[model samples]
Target: MSRLTELLSRIKAKDPKIGNELAKEIKVLSARRQFGLNFERHKPENVELANREVRRGDKIRVLPQRGSTKNSDKRLWQVKDTFKKKNDHLATIELLGHDVAETQVVKVEDLIVVAEFQDSIYPGLISTGKVEKGKDKPYNTVINGENYHALKALTFTHKGKIDAIYIDPPYNTGAKDWKYNNDYVESDDHYRHSKWLAFMERRLVFAKKLLNPSCSVLIVTIDEKEINRLGLLLEQSFPEAQIQMISSVINPKGTGRALFSRTDEYIYYVFIGSAKVPDKVGKGEEKEVRWRYLRRTDDESARGTKKGGPAQFYPIYVNKNTHKIEVIGEPLKPEDDISKIKNINGCVAVFPIREKDEHHMNWGLTKPSLEKALSKGFVRVSRKEDSQIQPYVFSYLTAPNIKKIDNGILYKKGQREDGSWIVVDPSGKSSRPTTNWNEKSHEAGAYGTSLLKALIGKRKFPFPKSLYAVEDALRIVVGENKEAKVLDFFSGSGTTAHAVMRLNRQDNGERQCISITNNEVSADEQKALIKKGFRAGDPEWEKWGICDYITKPRIEAAITGVTPQGKPIEGEYKFNDEFPISDGFNENAEFFTLSYHTPLAVNHNLAFKQIAPLLWMKAGSRGKRIQELPERGWEVADSYALLVDLDKSSEFIKPVKASKSITMVFIVTNDDRRFQAIVRQLPESVEPVRLYESYLKNFQFTIE
Candidate 1:
């Protein structure tokens, strides 16, 4: 048996569950070993004494520190008794005015510090890059030397800052598309999911700190394959967030000669808190039918009273001279004039009008309501001058015009006589969107498939979401709030960015997007870039050097807002670089320097002594004299002081009481012991002094 097989057998003998769980891993590793494929595994050389030595029954805390400079050589410092050593690998440290648990382990060669305390507090950081400001620039300004992988470095700087996060990481199917160290994980690898999970877990821990209370994360996934597992993982990572499912039926496939075609993909929507919920609209069935009036005809006569017309009654008007019936109001328009008025006909029907005194009601309206209608000119009355007894007069009540309309058939589909499909205009005398998705007849076009076919035609990516679908989803989530920021780390063909730009143009919004992707290019990718004129060694070409390809053409496409087909839209794109602080400092100072300070206001007695001479040089060259110490204040001996008593001396020293000359001194020290010693030596008579430490160190200091 191979060495790996033997190791697995031993593990199985000890713990059957662990052995069974890790069996697949052993087989894959063994296969790779036999095939001579290169797979790199990074292990910490130093054993991370703080994490590996946890003592039995000891509870410890883990705080991770990242992006330290290589040359700093600064060892992790620990205060002896303040924190008890729980184990050879663990220590309980006090932080944030409380004792907390910290773990010190080297996960993938990254530095972590573990402390033990009572409460659970995850130490994560934010990414310190230049944030985009206004319309003048299309992209954010990324400060040089910011490490992209070091999440802990960003916590203090980026806490509660991110509005949204979208990431598309490697699928880790072991198709030579992902790396274990610098090498790829080929197909049949057993630890594929484990590696992917670890990668995501580290980033997610940091990502949590970056979110605002109302922030949300959108993770795009395919099929039932890993979505459930991913959901579980997310639950573990962000216990405070609520998980929502948004299943987009992007592509319905018609496959079986015997079975129904398959269509649809799912998107997982996870939100931070109560602030997140899926957008929904009301849905129900119609229960009642009602009629509304359209127009009124003349009250002069009720037509269609002839023999051929359906049986109907017409109120007759008596003439004093002839006692004949006549139409009252002006004749109806040609279109409105009906050939005949009928009662109970198969095709048309009419109802008779009754007087208030008649006591019989034929319509739904009340007698008082009808009277009010007559008062408002809705009903009409006619009178004849020559009419005999009872003053020949006629009153006619209008019909409650009925029109046959579709009942609950709100949505429609299919193309019209013309080749184009029919679209329901929400405001154009049509129904609004309803919650019953099955009722929606509109397909949103053939592009509804979750795996959007590449715009350039062939499939360059395994699963690219349709731009329209993303926009639709965004419309439901963001609605009219157009200025929201969007992030998508797994930016394949840059569809999310494209969708954001398109949505912005359509709505005239100022929405911005940030996309993070690896430079690992696949076989399909190289062909795509080659078509775009990307060549090796070009300045514009280096953008594509990372695991996620970034070429000049890709960026140009984003800026011009064009698809692979070359259609122009309104958008802007720019490039930026993220680096770590170590990149800014020289090698010697990179690791050792914990913080830096920029000069703000400097008091003579509190400023760095070494810097004082530089300030003095600048002040003296300008012909201004340094002031002397004030009266009634304690002073340092032999140091130049800013004095209020200018008349007493031109010398650096001033006589306070003969032989006891007083001067002002600015002391600068980084050593805690030295700083304390200087403070104790100051005379009791001296007033309290103001001291300014390095701004970087000051920022890192916790009062407690």
Candidate 2:
């Protein structure tokens, strides 16, 4: 009769063990509903501190031995002491399990320190190398480190500034493609989906902060493996943004064990704030351009001498053999004789005359304007069949057609031999892209893998996205923004950077891309290294990581027009734009490895050298970074200024106003009133940022 008895009666009807001996001790418990995605939210994520040195009290784990069994030590340890023993560095460590005091000494080279997400870290960037084709261009950056830490650091440098974020994260194919808690999430792992979602959710939270608040986009590419789940995850993660999923056929030949061959993947575009698709044609959506005669033929008054202006009565000359619009002559007076005007080198002169009445019709544009149109290839010559006075007719683009070309509604295919422009109306190109896409260039095998192989000379990465696929995604979102700042935290093989360069080359844009990826070696390589008595942090082992082996080299090859081996790249890039790879791109790029620092060192203002790049990036990555502190307590670069001394505000404010290009001033002081007072003295165009406090608050590990 009680609630517990009522619950017991329901269970008794469905269970054979209801009245059994084991069921006698069973107690009724309340049930809670899990309506949506549920995962182990408290599960700790370990980040291996390969670049940091081993110190006392640091958490550590021993590298797997080659001949070790499955029962190898997976427990965590704390370093009690570190010392040199007989020419080898050793560390005394104690077990961090079940209050155990078991202690052991191991070679420091054989150990890797791991940091949990909850642990506080002061992150900095160390420049490893750079490739510059010109001095004026901003460097496209590539960071070799764990992406989570990179994104955490980006929250300070790039928050609310990125115009586009294109990421091709691991699809969690359950084939050891991704890792969770330092181990691969194999197909048999029961919590692989939950772990993948948790992993993505943490990074997406940071990604949302890095995107521009007023206008930006987040593009994620995924296949059937977790498309539906990823869709839901994105919706939950970006609740305030507009999200749309597009089905793109990356592989025409399906690869799957199911009845239906899986040939396509999906792309999620999260348009935030005022972001919208540009009015430009996408791939395979071009229409032929239709030309109209320049003469005003609709109204009779427009053709008469009374209404037509004197300057509009001009003659457009055409080559007799080529039929191309060669020259545009001065306008003749209404009383002047047409027969007296001399011909030019056998070229036929055609005037805007009515074919039916022999009345002088004015041109749509004046003589000077017609000459400018001829230079742009907007003027064309057509053969007239019925006209007596003139055997040829002059045709030109209407005002609306010219407006379309200027607005990017029409695409210029190329110029004709006659120096005329060939424009095509990309039908629906300026409209929103459809949900489904099937294009040959989007084929991964043909364009993605093969193209990368051609660029880097081998298949080092597993599966890179088709360069055109990334290019289209970026062009659709940031096409109108010529100087967009793009970021890709999961930029494996550096495809996003390559795509950014391709887009820049297409329109002479200045879009800078920041790519972040870790230097993780492949599974097979890891096995070989362990057999050779080499651990992860060793130079020999770390050199084979995805960043060093494939990403950096591929990006360098793409920019240098030569492969890693100094050989010229072998093929031509084909798609929306075509060019020989050997020509390379007139762009610059810099490579940096994410480094960790002690909070004490950063708090004392000793980490300025390491944090200089972040300031440059925050200033839109405009010019060379100011790598050192100035004696005057202030320094100005091409795009930003830094004021390290509060007393030097009077001097700093003068140069900043004179340097019209400087847009950001980082005043390094903790006093808000002083900072605000200094900001008021500066030009309205310049943004004042408080350093130290602003920088330290971002690294407090708030998001994780």
| Top TM-score hit | 2
Model 1 global lDDT (CA atoms, 0 to 1)? 0.37
Q: Report the alpha-carbon TM-score of model 2 versus the true structure.
A: 0.75
TM-scores for all predictions = 0.39, 0.75
**True-structure RMSD for candidate 2:** 15.0
lDDT by residue (398-459, candidate 1, tens digit) is: 34311111332322234332122222212232244332232121132343232133223332
How would you encode candidate 2's per-residue C-alpha lDDT over 1-704 as one tens digit per residue?
38656676777777655343224443211221255454555365888887788888888888666434343356789999999978999999998855547989899877778887867777889998888874597889999988988988888888888999999999998776778877888988888888898899889988988899898999999988889888888887787889999999987888775678889988999999999866555556886576665665434434435667678877778888887877778888877888888789978888866543455667778877778777777877657554465677566766788898889888788876666677887664535567898988898888888888987886578988898888888888887788999999998899899999999987889989999999988888877777787766779988899998888988998988878877766555775765446557889998989888776677677988888888888887777578998998999999999998889889888899999789898988878999999999989999888888888787875433
User: Cα lDDT of all candidates, in order?
Assistant: 0.37, 0.80
- Superposition error at 597 for model 1 (Å): 18
lDDT of 2: 0.80
Residue 614 error, candidate 2, Å: 1.0
Candidate 1 residue-wise lDDT at 388: 29
Candidate 1 local lDDT, residue 176: 60
